[model samples]
Target chain A: MEVVDEGSDGRVARVSLLRTPLFEAHRAAGARLVEFAGWEMPVQYEGIMAEHAMVRERAGLFDVSHMGQVEVRGPRALERLQWVTANDVSLLADGRAQYSLLLAPDGGIVDDIIIYRQQADRFLVCVNASNREADVAHMREHCAGADLVDRSDEFALLALQGPRATEVLGELTDTELSEVSSFAFVDATVAGVSCLAARTGYTGEDGWELYCSAASGPALWAAILDAGRDQGVGPAGLGARDTLRLEAALPLYGHELSLEVQPFEARLGWVVKLDKGDSIASAALRQARERGPERKLVGIEVPKGGIARQDHALLDGDRRIGTVTSGTRSPSLGKAIGLGYVEPQLSRVGSEIAVEIRGRKVPARVVALPFYRRPD
Target chain B: MEFPDDLKYSKEHEWVLVEENVATIGISAFAEHQLGDVVFVELPATGDEVAKDEAMGVVESVKAVSDVYSPVSGEVVEVNDDLPENTELVNDDPYGDGWMVKIEMTDPTDLDDLMDCEEYQKFCAETSG
Candidate 1:
């Protein structure tokens, strides 16, 4: 497999882009296709704002089949996973999922992953699209003596996310989705296709992600869209997906998690189980825990006006402090918000700062993460 | 896609409405359509002087930023103050409510070089292809 490098700046190389199974569906829906993580994916269908609003108010369907999946099965699967990944795999109960990370030997992040414990000795690891090849190589090197299979090409993934996601999905599947709590999974049939239904999503909304055979993708997609036609279910692309995740403060791979960034620095320290017996980068993470991270990631807002974008320099009275990692004009809040890393001391909430945009300083303030949250 | 017959257009996709010495300017519908969705706009002050074919303002969409060039040289007499908060006007009604600026023309002869609606419609088709 050819491994393409998508730089930290988010620029794509003009190579032959791969297509998902639902590429024709996106084109039929009038989606604007853009190359993302080496795949020709839909960036937007109707518009970013309208699709984002639809997902928040009703339901949205996303074709995330480009993401890579790995299966580890054997009597020693748990031991091998515990040795390679940062989190304690033993804590993951059967039919439950966990958000964890694959770490380098020096505590740098390889990729942020979600592990589904399908059985006592079976696991399904979902990895980022851009890091699929590298993650497989890394896993094979460390996770020896176990049957590790790269099942990325065999499965198609769809994320149905929003307030009415369950209601819409419930109509098509007899999985009793409501009983599958957050971060849980069920192996059942959806739309007459056998699949794994997981109640998890990156949009910070209550939703379920379905994984089915590649040949079953188009059929299931059509059925869900038909079932969700009345619930305001719209075909959403990556553009709305990005803005929604940004509002939720969920980090993307290249933007928030990178080889040079540690979990603590990215405000993802919860996934790093230092006490979880000898795993990859445990020693380095222990030392970093002792010394404390010098820099910290923070959520920032330009309450007055102006949108800050990636690579925009942040300033403290002309002294350069950090660079914005992710930013967008929030469709939900009707304000500009972003995420960046800066000196730990400067990351305090209410601390005033400035973002330099096109040689002009835009006043900003540090705010708490997750710029948007679903009200109970 | 929309070239208003009442306005003259620049090659850079800006539309100009010349009435006496005052020239009202905004982007063409083709420009707005190519720009997806407008989320923010940055404009110059009312008194700022601007030269024709130069960058006078910026229109930012959800994905990218584009410069709005001046169609004719002039001193800025007025700017659309509501554009900062409601940038969608550029996408909704580019010819009317979305006018970016009104200029006190420094050279009315500059209007002679601009394309009329018929010529601009052909130009848009050729350029887009």
Candidate 2:
């Protein structure tokens, strides 16, 4: 690699570690560090492909402490959350988490979040690290009687994902994960660390997300890692995290789902509840849903030769049709896979398109969502 | 850390093993380590002509894509066809089966301007720090 000297300013202030308690442990395990969302996080430890393969075949642990967690409590919590998020919170049962979107008045997505109803008067919302402050402010502004509190500093989040994740996590916690269905959470303890363990993950695998205090995070991580040593619980990084989520066809905050892109255009209509009473952006969502999105998100697969990349022009012969939003050479599929916005007519599966790769148009076909799916 | 004393190095991290008019090119071990598990390689055509320091090809890892710079002006001769099917060879055996291309050098004198193994190693050490 060409090492360019983008010289530092030399102002040696105390560089904050946007760290979980496992920060030092990760460094000790030989993780290559990179800056991500204002935190110095590991991009990969062993290698991307190795870690990715491990997760697919066995299990993997991911430090997702960089994600923001906020608690909304009081009698009006559910009502206030319904006003801010696109999904109806009244439908969510206690200990259940629902994926929803916070929208601007124009029906564009502010941030896609997961709202976990902890109790009748309390709910926890997990948001993107970069958009945490904005999400908090947005919720606070819209909330009338509910108390909005940012608990990101008090808690650390860890995702144990893969097929063997249940076996690994089951060894540590007393609670039976089999009793908890997908998207459901339970308050439990692992190695004496008070944790809220949920059966949810971003990797499209069977996994559990553990939220605990900052001081006890490292101990919990170590205990799980130790328990899962024989099960091949590799520590995954942001590199595999991106590829795995992309292969699963999950919409990322800044990519497929963005402030300028409506939920309908992003193919997240399943999460938007239109008939659940009037709320902010509900009218706009209804209008968008009725008319149908002008542009729709579609999965693209390049059969041969070139890999389609982000910003690559999508073409129908000579006519430029759309642009690729997220693209990568899928390690699992062994082909170039991408997600892009195309005209609704061209978004059908099996529809042929072309992607201009290095000035030459390469053949691509619109494929089904999720290039890879884990076996349930 | 291993640099062959007989090879010439470029600032872009490509190492050239020159034999008469033909030069074999591959990224150095240091380069492969930094790039981390090369997932894709865009090799040039066999007949394509490239200029000194021009974009020879592209190498993609899981994280980012980097442009591979041509170390010297030459006519494209033989590209490593195995790379597309097995890009991880660049990470495993970067200087052997992982060699990207073999180019017929138009000007052999250009080799003199490139860094030697000792100088290149020192350059890498200084730059990484």
Candidate 3:
């Protein structure tokens, strides 16, 4: 880790960033490193477009070690989780995962998370890197009787995703990965390393997210790459990750889910169980459901010449509509795609809208999300 | 990495080739390398008037969009018609076919603020380090 100091004026400040266990491996592979969530992580290994295409066509490996993991276990773990989470945690059977959110008192999202049920009294919670500490503190404040342990640093997570991911991962493991249904995981061994392999991914592709010891990250990464060498498996970075997830219409913590934005407006109302009795923020959320959301999150498609970057305003012929949350040139679609909030009436599938891109009002339209769904 | 001795460079990494009063403009090799995989390019119109140190056009990659700044104030005479469709020219041949626009200079004295090849190379080094 490098601690760089900035003294542009008289005052001095020190900035030190943490690194994943595969930091040296990424450096040796000639990746462009960037600061993400106080961690030094790779933004790109090859070009973003090429890597994006690779993940869609073949398999790609991702080092998602920056994501935090917490083990919550006790006699009251299930009851405690149901109290803090927006989703009904009681519905998940053992080895099943549910996408849920931690909400503030005002029904604003604290962090979107994945709760993996390991047993009746135990669960593993996966959280975004930036919100890990805050989420832990929030959980502790609410669930004092439950045992909460931060295990983010103790494990490294690797996501292998694509159309060919099953075939590639099959070569190294004896388990029948095809039988493991979506959002379910099993304790398995891959490439001679023990891992909890889950059939879940952010890329909206058929894949497995392997959670193993931090010390085994480098070897596991190399072995998977080597095992899939003939299938053109490559290491993907944050740049490709963002584009892939956006095409899937998955909400990021800062961009789509935030402390200011409530769940219903972000198209996350399905995850909020207002009828689930006595949960945090459920009262405020029930009132919000009674009074429908003013703005709804929709997909935006721009024409030629302009790329709709974040914070660009959405307009309906000079009428202030909403603001863009995240935007990028879709490598798979070969067109401009973005996510933004707009008035509910304007959120229809083919409503015509325009986005302000660099002082010009480019022609845009509200479109359906999950812009690039994989072939069935 | 290749900065032609006959050309002048700006801190924004644009290169200018002054042929008499008209200055031809393009991004340098370093800029193209830093912005990998050029996906779109928007050049100024042929008759548009451009001001020095101001945005003249736009270049977009997969992740970001960057504005191309003019090094000399001028009236655009010729624009790159091939670049909008063949954006890879900016990354492949940044000095030749990748040339963005040719402008008839309004103030030729703006060339005094430009850096030569050696100076531009040193500037890139210091900024990168």
Best by TM-score: 3
lDDT of 2 by residue, A44-104 (tens): 9998888888888998999999899999999999988888888889999899999999988
Docking quality of model 2: it rates as medium
Per-residue lDDT for A208-271 in model 3, tens only?
A: 8999999998999999999988999899999899999999999998998798888999999899
DockQ of each: 0.71, 0.67, 0.74
lDDT of each: 0.91, 0.89, 0.92
DockQ, candidate 1, comes to 0.71
Identify the superior model by lDDT, candidate 1 or candidate 3. 3
Error in Å for residue A32 of model 2: 1.2
Candidate 2 ranges with C-alpha deviation above 4 Å? A1-17
Colliding pairs, model 3: none
Interface RMSD, one decimal, each candidate: 1.0, 1.4, 1.0
Which tens-of-lDDT digit does each residue in B58-95 have in candidate 1?
88887778899998998999999999888999999999
Say which docking band candidate 1 falls in.
medium
Give the chain A TM-score for each candidate. 0.96, 0.95, 0.97
